[model samples]
Target: MSSFPQIPQTIADEQQLDDWLTTPSSELIEFVRTLSGDLLVLGAGGKMGPSLAVRAKRAIDAAGSPASVIAVSRFSDTTSRQWLDDRGVVTHAADLLDRNAVEAIPDAANVLYMVGTKFGTSQNPAFTWAINTVASSQVMQRFAGSRFVALSTGNVYPFVPVASGGATEDGPIGPVGEYANAALGRERVFQYFSTCNGTPVTLMRLNYAVDLRYGVLTDIGLRVFSGEPVDLRNGYLNCIWQGDANDAIIRALGTAESPHCLLNLTGQETLSVRAIANEFARLLERPVQFTGEETESALLSNSAKCCDLLGAPQISTETMIRWTADWLRQKGRLLNKPTHFEVRDGKF
Candidate 1:
């Protein structure tokens, strides 16, 4: 495996962060070289979408492909749209929930479906279902012939024993909460379309994608730094670097199937949140607080299949923890988005 690249301790601004996140690996470039046709990334304004879109552009350029990376999103923030626009990624602003707007998007051979809602599911599950299931139905109908990679959540899997090495791709999906159930419904929608229309689709079950700005590591690091007690109920969890996740998503485009395929994507190890908190305490030179006892089972994923097929993640968890610590110490800009990984009931 290639050595993990060194992450700078202090990122000066968002552009620098974008550069770091979008820097393409040789493997990613090689993967893109095997592809032809422009790429369309739907719901490209989310946390992972911006960097993923930029990565696609960089990879296509590196592969010397004429494929343009077009990112379509509601684009509530013009800054994100401008960021993609400036980086050679075509940006389109549209409410994908609108059937007319969905029909208006230019068809592309390769499509990345990144739209879904998890937070506020309890208070507004109708909206969640609309975005996760209804919108996806329309999207599938609109792009029935295009190869698609849809981002699903690991929460769809029931809590499993910590020693089970996480849930495998073939594991039974027994989601515990409305959010997860709605996510499963989203998957079923695509599966239905894939089966009926012979549309090639790959469902990417991603748990957590970490960067310094906002993620499980950053969540714990901030809590430890603030001397707030870290909850240990959902002690064991998994995460992968956002960049590595992006690589896997793009690579999975090649694996899309008519009946749909499923791949669990996350880091290999089952991490202890308490242990991670202690590590962050050591890094921050602060005392750590603890609350709630560790549970035997937590939401986890087995990504061995993803590793075997799409290559192992390049960034190690230890490296990510250290980078996150350094980022927090240097007062790096955070997107203020929390993972809510600590929640045991899956309320968020």
Candidate 2:
């Protein structure tokens, strides 16, 4: 494995966070240059969208391209809107479910669809279906002419044996719970529209994109640091750095096909929850607790095709573990969003 720049031990302020968010690689710059016209990111208020939008804008600027990066979301929290605005990413506030609102979004030659719901699925499965399935239909209808890279979850795939090195893009679509099923619907809707209108589409099945604020690594690190018991049932998993995910999402624009392309985008390694907790304990000098036993199968993905298409992730799991531990120990800012990656039943 080639070494990448290590994340700083401590991030002092929001400015540092912004710097980390927008930094791009040479590949990203070349990818952004290839994209012409405006770049629209739907569902830009989510955990990954803000940084991704900023990264796109920065990449376009670096490449000296004329394309503008526009982020569309409800912007219920003005903080996120301000964050994107400060970074020169144009922000649009609108409910994606609203047909008029979605149609009103400026036309773009390239788009990254990030709209989807995971939490509150049990209590309100209808809304989950609407957001994941219905909204996807709306976005596809609205952006039928644009080159699209839709973000789908790896939850669409069934659990596989740890020794399998995770499920590939051709894995069966047997989602475990309501949320997972709806995610499958989301992909189907996009596929349907792509086929109907002959629009180019790329369905990116992302597993876990880790960062200090919110991810499987941070979730486990914080649990270990807090001395809480980490569940081990879903022991093996895959993760990629949020920055790497963002870059791959952008680069997927070029890989879009008329009948739609499906690709798994995640880390190559199949990580163990038990081992991750121990790594966290080692880094933070804290006691770690574990409950339950490792299961034979777990939600995992094989991103070989994506890595072959795009490049391998720069940030390694070791770097992420150390960064997460130092961030927790130093009391860095947190998004307070729990990934709930340990949920074996896929409740969330």
Which predicted model would earn the best lDDT?
A: 1
lDDT of 2 at 14: 62
TM-score of each: 0.97, 0.97
lDDT of 2 by residue, 4-101 (tens): 24667556666776677668777888877777799999999999999999989988998999888999999998999998999889999989889999
Model 1 Cα lDDT, one tens digit per residue, 1-348: 112357565555666777878988787788889887889999899999999999999989988999999999999989889989998999988898899999999879999999999888999989998999989999999999899999999999999999999999898998878899999999999999999999999999999999889999999999998889999988989999898898889889988998999999899999999999999999999999999999899999999998988888888899889888888888888888999998978788
The Cα error of candidate 1 at residue 119, in Å, is 1.0
What's model 1's overall lDDT?
0.90
Worst 10 residues of 2 by lDDT: 1-10
Which segments of model 2 are wrong by more than 4 Å?
1-13
The per-model lDDT (C-alpha) reads 0.90, 0.88
Q: Which ten residues in a row have the lowest lDDT in candidate 1?
A: 1-10
Error of 1 at 191 (Å): 0.7
Any idea what lDDT model 2 has? 0.88
